[model samples]
Target: MSPDLSLIFVLGLRMAVAAAFVVSASIIAERSGPVIGALVATLPISAGPSYVFLALDHDAAFIAEGALASLPVNAATLFLALTYVLLAQRHGLLLSLVSALAVWFLLAAGLRALDLSLVGGLIANVVAFAICVPLMQRYGHVKMPLITRRWYDIPFRASLVAVLVAAVVTLSGRVGPAITGILALFPVVFTSLMLILHPRIGGPATAAVIANGGWGLMGFGVAIAVLHVAALRFGSAVGLSLALATCVGWNLALWWNGRRKVAVAK
Candidate 1:
């Protein structure tokens, strides 16, 4: 196939993967309640596929560096989530979402301009999430009933994710690798979740869900770092496998503990 055609084909495939994963996870989240939904959102469904494509287009070394960069980028996303969580309390969905995206863009840009390494990025993510989680819990306690259905909800969500994935892929090369990696990991899934759930379940519940997902992202940060090292030592396929395993294990443990605590509290 010609390079142009191949690029189109690959971009289509990436969009398909991203859309399907986000929609499926969103459906499950709606049925399963907020915490489980949050856990599902943290699975790297969108970012994982993007990383695969990056590795395919470039090589293991490129993927490794991107993954390393991805760790620090988590802080930016956490900031985004927190922004939404806080704003959603006193504002409408559109206002909260717009503010959150602006914050994400600024933080991502600033972080990309800095000279950060794996250890530094990891530390930044850890601190950001650690500080934000408690504040999120404090602010995100308002609750509401499950929302009425809308005919456009699923289609709107699927299309939004697809567009975001395409935009990130198209823009990745224009920016440097660090910024590319950060943009690639943009909170597409999280955005979809909040957009759908906020109107339906109300802002408080939606914010709580995103906050929970933000805490869960620590696992994702660690997994990306591991993927970087493992991909360098081994290869993309093996490295991704190990990284997914590590992330899944961490997520499951967190879910179990969270569930157990909920049960005990009840």
Candidate 2:
């Protein structure tokens, strides 16, 4: 293959892989209850693929530094969830999303500016969860409503994930690790959910889904923290593997606990 053709082929392959992964997650999210949806939403569907590509291009040290950048940013996502949930209570989709995004950017900027050490990253997540979790407890349990699936939902989510994957893969070399890590966790899936759900079921119901997402996202914070340590001690490949495992393990524990509760109740 020619250089141009190879580049196109690679980009297409990345898009296909990312789209397939994310669409599956979105399908489960759409079919399952809100808690399940939240768990699916928290999976590394976006960041995982991006980090995989980044690992191919960068070294373990680079991956470790990127995780450091990612830590506070990961914490920032919870605030984005919280901001949207609160604003969505009385606001329309545009205002709520735009406002929530604005809050995310502001908080992300502040957190990133902290010149965070690993401990600082942990503290950021600790503080964010401390503030957001109890509040989310009140809002997270709203029942998932059955709604007709729109024809555009699949394409919309697939496109969103594709664009994000493409951007991260193509730009990782150009932007350096810090920016790459920041871009990797840009909440593309959540944005897709907001676009689809906020209109279908209205704000509060959607907020329930987003609110429950906070728990899963907290696991992501742990994953990044693991990445920071493991990448430096091991290699990027091992680090990424361990980090992904941490996230998967945490979510699995939550799911099992949830199931156990259901069985006990029944």
- After superposing candidate 2 on the true structure, give the runs of residues whose Cα lies further than 4 Å from its correct spot: none
Collision pairs in model 2: none
TM-score of each: 0.91, 0.96
Judge candidate 2 against the unseen true structure and give its global Cα lDDT, from 0 to 1: 0.88
Query: Evaluated with lDDT, which candidate comes out highest?
Result: 2
Residues 1-266, candidate 1, lDDT per residue (tens digit)? 99999989989988888888888988887777667878888898888877776667677877788787777788888889889999988888999999999998888778777868888888888888887777787764445366676899888888987887787678766765566678678888888887888877778888877877866788888888899899999998888998899889988999889879999999
Position 34, candidate 2: lDDT: 79
Candidate 2, residues 174-247: lDDT per residue as tens digits?
A: 88888787888899888888989999989888888888888899999999999989999999989999999999
Candidate 1 stretches greater than 4 Å from native: 1-6, 139-144, 171-176, 263-266
RMSD of each: 2.1, 1.2
